[model samples]
Target: MRRRTPRVRPAALAFATLFGLADAAAQTSYQSMGRLFTTPSERMMLERQRSDNRAAAAAPATPAGPALPPVPEAAPAPPPAPQRVGGFVRRSDGRATVWVDDEARETTLPRVAPGAPLPVDLGGRNVIIKPGQSYDPSNGTIQDPR
Candidate 1:
């Protein structure tokens, strides 16, 4: 015949019974405990968002300043003086033609009359003609030289 062996310890058996009862009680109460309410930190974040929205809605609509006047346009300036190059004296034609650096230019005047000094343009350097003297065009020199 085979010998019989002990299967459970007295202290271990009592501890197992206590643990099973505690697990059953926890399971039964799980649904009865309601969900946690909103925390303080979440409430503060919501309040801050509400304040920001209210401030944006209350902001001013128009800019603060007086209107500016319209500006007027300016007029254009006059042309510059012509540069003289040479002159001519015409005794026969009774007219002198003044030559400018630009060939297209021709300023003519009556020839120097008696008792009046002859008008002359020495070269493209200077204008030696006195007042009332005619500018000559035939030659680049003054006629009736004083």
Candidate 2:
């Protein structure tokens, strides 16, 4: 009596072939790949390797002169200018002018809810922000912190 073999799907056959090829290519070594010690080497071989590595590492292959003093690298460029500051809120508006110590500075801030902390930069000084006040670039004044 003749035995019948199971028929394989063409898609499955192709997938199996491709997957096998990719896996074979990815795993090219016949030896153990990782530190899991799946296939350990002979004790003598490991001892020999360890000894060779120790000898090679203990002494520099090349005879080199004393190391030179390392020249200090230039100090890193100063950090970027401070962008934001912590302070009390004076007004919450998208368009507002600010005063940076005698010099009037025009700055725009997003609209903020009433009673929320308003950001007021008074010439690098602390300033309190009032609620419901929009930051009008034209009129920059009286933004003093409480």
Candidate 3:
């Protein structure tokens, strides 16, 4: 009886070599071109920041100039008018429901503490309404709880 030896196929060997080379090329290209691409505006902003840093580093220390008259601060703006009416309603399931006059649906609102006062814009007056209490939107007054 004669013994035969096992042989490797040429096509299979070529496919394995091709895949190995492709994987290595992909890793090399990613390492070479991995810098993040930025938009034109971002590039300009970065350039401006770099120039400012360079200028500050190059400038020499000098004595302060004469103290100019202190610029007057602008007056603070007034508070905005109330836009809508809303309040909290305590549910039997230990959660509160927030009802807004303009919104179509009421959402579950969790309070930091139970019975905490929730701010509501009633007409033009800002009123603090507690859970389980009702309010009148027309007059901005609290109504008897139902």
Q: Using TM-score as the measure, which candidate wins?
A: 3
lDDT of 3 at 93: 75
RMSD of each: 31.8, 11.5, 11.5
**What is the per-residue lDDT of model 3 for residues 4-122, given as tens digits with 9 covering 90 to 100?**
99888999999999999999999999999977745888889889999999999899967599767989999887654333334456677755556655453344444556667676544
Candidate 1 per-residue lDDT, tens place, 98-145, comes to 444434334455555644443334334345554334334434444442
Q: Which residue runs does candidate 2 get wrong by more than 4 Å? A: 1-43, 55-63, 85-112, 118-146
Where model 1 places Cα greater than 4 Å from the true spot, the runs are 37-146
Error of 2 at 125 (Å): 18
Q: How big is the positional error of residue 68 in model 2, measured in Å on the Cα after superposition? A: 2.2
TM-score to native of every candidate shown: 0.24, 0.26, 0.31
Q: Which ranking of candidates, highest lDDT first?
A: 3, 1, 2
Over 4-116, each residue of candidate 2 has an lDDT whose tens digit, in order, gives 99999999999999999988977875444655443456666778899999998998677488877999999987643322222223345545654443344566665667556
TM-score winner between candidates 2 and 3? 3
lDDT of model 1 at residue 115?
44
Q: Candidate 3 at residue 97, lDDT?
A: 54
Task: Provide the lowest-lDDT 10-residue window in model 2.
Answer: 81-90
- Compare candidates 1 and 3 on lDDT and give the better one: 3
Model 3 segments beyond 4 Å from truth? 1-15, 23-76, 87-89, 100-127, 130-146
RMSD of 3: 11.5
